[model samples]
Structures are given as structure tokens and as C-alpha cells.
Target: MDRIRKIFLVSINNIRKWATNPRIYVLFILITMFLWSSIRPILSFSKEMGIRVTPWVFPHLASSFVGQLILMLGVVLLFCDAPFIDEGQPYFLIRSGRYTWGMGQVFYIMMGMTIYLLIVNFISILILMPNIFLSTGWGKILGTLAENHGESVNEIEYISKKILLSYTPLKAFVLSFILEWCAGTALALLMFVINICLNRAAGATIASLIILLDYAIYSNFPSVKFFYFSPVSLSKLILIDSKGISNYPSNEYAYIFFIITIIVLSIISVLSVRRKDIQVQPAV
Candidate 1:
């Protein structure tokens, strides 16, 4: 209980400091809101064209937002250098349980991500609902068009069905978090590896190379199960249709592959951190 309390206090203090930083949070909020707001027009346009939108749209936007969140979070972890030795007179000593401290950081990151996702989701739902109604209620306009074109209402039925079927918020959040955690952690690990290897610039180059390689392989040859290790591939697995993942009929295997890959990657990351040398250098 004492250890848990200590960890909680440490985490709380870290969050407080972060929260006090107004500029970063403000910019983050603005960018996310802007992205969420942009979807309104798209929803309106789709409705006008006799197309229905899916609730899946929210999660898709959320996924992209989470990706950007992960990227920013990675920069913070890498540049701030948490749980590692810092030369600036250790403010809070790990003293006994270093593992706890590391775990605390993990928990903090996950919590921060969850909160961010929830807030953005709430804003998106608020902004999108009325626009969706306007788009779908174009009954008279649609009727005139259908009569002129000699087409039946069945032409727009697919969109209507899609709108009705696609609003899986719970599923979207679960899938979004899973992909976000995997991608976020991977990026952080990559940044850590880069920091250890060739300074910031070199690490950026290597990380970019890795991302490109991951995308290239997944796009060209997805049949190989190992590609699931790549965050992009993992996101694809979550977002794309089961068969869309490399044409394999059974997606069960792909999911299993992703789980195993995430485990392996996580283990490797922990080991890397455990063995990493802590030496402060110029922040790049």
C-alpha cells in the first residue's frame, strides 16, 4: 500500500506539472477540435448526395487524433527523459522500487491517452449530430433526382443501411485504444533506441526509415504475419475489413499475430530500458 501510494503521488505530481503547461495543452486542444470540426461538412455533403454516414466515422477520426497524440507524447517521453537518471539533482529518488516508477510512467501515459480520446469524442459527437440530420433529410431533393434519372430509391438504400449499422462507439474506443497503445509505445521505444544510437537527428532518420519500411511491407505484401509488428499495420488490422488484411479469409490468425507481436515488442522495450545506460547529454 505504501508503494502504491508513492507511485500514485509521483504520477499525480507529474500530471500536475504537465497540466500547468498551458501552451502545449491549448495547442493540442485546438488542433484536435479543428480536425473534428472539419468532418461536419463532409457529413453534410455525404447526406446531400443521398449517402449515409457511419458511426465508424467517429472512431476513424479518433484513431487519427490518437496517432498525433502518440507522436506528441513520444516527443515528451524522449525529450523529458523520465524514470531515467537525470543530472539535475534527482528531485524524487526512486530509492527502492525503480520498476514501480517505470510502471507509473506507463500508467500515466495510458491514462492521459484515455482522457484525451474521451474529450475529443465528446466534442465530435456534439458537432456532428445536427449536420448528419440535415444531410439525411434531403427527401424532396432526392425524390426529384431519382425521378429525373429513372432510378429507384434503392440506389440510396445502401447509405441508409450503413448509417444505421456503423455507429459502434464502444467498439471504436476499444479498437482505438488498442491501436493507440501499440503505436504510441512503439514510437516511444523507437525514440529511446534512437536517443541511444545516433543522437536526435540520426534517430529521426532511423525512425522514419522504420515507419516507411513498415508501411511499404504492409501495403505491398500483407500476407506475411510479421508485418503486424508495425504500428501502421496494426492500425490497418483494426480499421480495415478482415479480408482486407492481405486477402486471408481468416482474420483470427492475424489478430493472434498482432497480440504476440505486441507482447514481444513490449518485452524487448522493457529489457532495453532496464539495460540502457543513463547519461545526460544535450537535449536535441
Candidate 2:
């Protein structure tokens, strides 16, 4: 129990130090650019039509393939400095024991990813503050855009019709958030494991290569077999057909794939931290 508390303390301290982290600002800047492009179109459509929207705009903003791609890349930048270690970390690790320290690093990944995703969602809502409202439905313009968005609608504005037909606004938003969190956490873990087992440069590089590879393979291949191994695809609900007859993997399969991958990577992370000589260099 005391060890658990110590681990939590380490994780919390890491979170607190995020104020000193430059990457956090860079992440927000990236997110704002991506989100502004996404939300601006919706806001424009709403103003032209004079119709208020539901609070579920975030899902649509993140629904497109391009949005997801940028998001994956941004998350890579967000946690690029995985294991979040500095010169001060070595002394702390000595006091906390590598086992507790390793677990704390894992906790940091979980917390950090959660914060990243929540910021995305919050900014989406914030952008649409006056124009959007709390509602169970996808609202006027979103509903139309989802099903039969005419030529008048900008190409930048998008929400999958399959999403509207298959799930409610709340469900779509909830699922998108959950899936992104899972995939982002998985990527962070991959970086963490590699950073501990190998070197920092290799860790970030390999994780990025995997992401680019995943996007290329899935984008080009588009096969059910491929989805079984792809991390980013699991975040895409549009790929999953409601009838279960499409080529995409089912929801159940995506969850299992993510859970298994995260668990295995997390186990490796703990083991690596405990057994490996994880050297920390001074922050420059």
C-alpha cells in the first residue's frame, strides 16, 4: 500500500512538473490548429443556417481520417520524451526502488494521455461555446452533414453518416474519446518500453515509424485481417459497420486488440525498468 502511494506521488509530481514542460505548449498549439480547421467549418455552417448545434461536435471534428492522422502524430510529440526522466529522476528512483518507479512511469503514461485527450475534447466544446448547446441529438446541421451534406457544405466539414445511423451523439462522442485514449496510451507505452529497453531517440523514432507504417498499411490495404494488428484503426468507428457484414473488424475485436497490446507493453515496461540500467541524462 505504501509502495502504491509512493508510485502515485511520483506520478503526481510528474504531472505537476508539466508546467515546466515545453512540449505541453507545443501540443496545445498543434491541437488548436487542427481543431480550428475542424470547428471553423461547423461554426460557419451554423452561422449561415442560423441553427444551434449539440455538444457532440468534438467527435465529428476528430472523425475524419486526416484528423486522426494528425492526432496520432501530435500524441507522438506529446509523449516523445517518454519515461519522463531527468537527472533528478535517478535519485528518486534509488529511493523509490525501480519497481515502484517503473509503475509510477506507467501511471504517468495513463494520466498524461488522459489529460491530452480531455484537452482535445474540451477545446472542441470551447470553440463552439455560444453556438452549441447540451442535447442528446446531433442537432440540425450535424445531422444533415452526416447523412446528406450537400455541395454547399465545405469539404472540411465532415461526420460519417454511418456514425449517425449506428450510434447516438453521446455514444459516438464517448466511443471516440475512449478509443483515442486507448490508442494514444498504447503508443505512449510503446515509447516508454523502447526508451527504457533501448535509447530515447530509438524509442521515439520506432514508435513514429510504426504509426506511419500503420497509416500506410491500413489506408492502402483496408482489410479485416490488417485491423487485428493496427492500433490507430481501432480508434476509427466509421470502419466498423453496424451490420457486422463489412470488411472492418468488429467493436469487440478492436477492444481486445487494444487491451492485449496495452497489457503486454505495460508488462514489458515494468520488467524493463526493473532489470535494465535505465540511465537518465540532464535536461538540456
Candidate 3:
């Protein structure tokens, strides 16, 4: 119990240190502003067309191309300087058990990513407040699609409408938020593992590339889409309707895969850190 408390306190201190860093907060706000600006035009167009928008629309937009670009960049920037890269690591490496230190780093990444998502999502809700309406089901929004059966709608719009119709507005919001959190956690853990094996820059670059590649492959090859492990896959898994309307894999399976991946990556990171020689210079 005492050891756990000590580790918790150490992790909290690390989180506080990170919280004091201006760059992370600055990047977070900038990303939020960029997302808001990008979505403003869409909201305006929706209003012009007399389309009833819901709060759930923002998550769909945030997961779009522009939104994904900003999100991936923000994540890379925010975590590119993980604790493993800090200078004078030998001194601190022995101060705490490697496992504890690794756990602290994990906690730090989780907290940072949570804050980033919350801020971005909060800003999105605020921007769409005027058009935001809580609906019990998708019947309200899908009416737009029904009215324009001949019009060609994009896959994103189709999926978003299906999600909104299948789930209540509040349920959609909570599910979307949970999916984002899970994806962020998985991504952060993966990057940390990469940082353990390679340098921070390489980790960040490769992590971002993995996400892009996953998206590209999933977009082009619908059959093998489920094989890739990326935030895009996680998001898509969450957006799948209960009736298998999207023809995607079940959420239960995807979630289980995410859990397994996180556990495997976390164990690998901890083991690597434990065996790593502290005599070498820091990567930072």
C-alpha cells in the first residue's frame, strides 16, 4: 500500500510538472481553435439548408480528414518529449523502480490525452450549441436523408446519421467520448513503447504514420480494414450500429483487441525500461 501510494504521488508530481508546461496547453488550444474554425462553415451550411444538427455531429467532424490531421499532429507534439527522453535519466532512473517510473509515465500520458480530448470536445459542443438538440433516436435526423434519397451522401455523413439514429443523443455523446478516450490511451501507450525502443521523434513520427496508414488501408480495402490497429479503426468500431448496418466488426471484438494491445504494449514498455541501461545519455 505504501509503495503504491508513493508511486501515485510521484505520478501526480509528474503530471503537475507537465501541466505547468506552456507548450502543451498552447498546442491544445490551437488545435481546438482550428477544429472550431473548420467546423464553422459546415454548421453554417447546415443551418442554411435547414438541417437539424445535433451535438453528436461534432465527433463525426472531429474524426474527419481535417480533424484527424489536427488530432494526430497535436498528439504527436504533446507526447514527443516523453519522460524517457529527459536528460540526466541515470539520476532519476534509480530514484524510483523502473516499473513505477514507467507506470508514472503511463499515467502522465493518460492524463494529458484525457485533457486534450476533453478540451477539444468541449469546444466543439460549445460551437454547435445553437444547433445542438437532444434526440431520443435517429428518426429526426435521418428524415433529411429520406427526403433527399436521390442525393449522394458521403460515407461519413451516412455513418454519423446511422449512429445518431441508433443511439440517443446523450448515449452517442458518451459513447463517442469513450471511444476517443480508448483510442487516445492505446495510441499513447503505443508511442511510449516506441519511445522505449527508439527515440521520441521516431516514436512520434511512426505513431502518426501508423494512424495515417491505417486510415488509408481501411479506406481503400474494406475487407481487411479490421486488421489494422489504429485510432481510425477504434472510431469506426464505435460508430457501428447495433444491427451491423455498417458491416464492420463488432464493438465487443474491437474493444477486446484494443485491451489486448494496450496490455501487451504496456508490458513490453515496462520490461524494456527495466532492462534498459541507465548509463547511456538521454535521447532528449
Sort the predicted structures by lDDT, highest score first.
Answer: 2, 3, 1
Give the number of the best model, judged by TM-score: 2
lDDT (Cα) of model 1: 0.47
lDDT of 2 at 137: 79
Which residue pairs overlap in candidate 3's backbone? 138-165
TM-score of each: 0.60, 0.94, 0.78
Error of 1 at 180 (Å): 3.0
Candidate 3 segments exceeding 4 Å error: 42-54, 84-93, 129-159, 222-231, 237-241, 245-247, 278-284
Clashes of 3: 1
Clashes of 1: 0
The top-ranked prediction according to lDDT is 2
Ranking by TM-score: 2, 3, 1
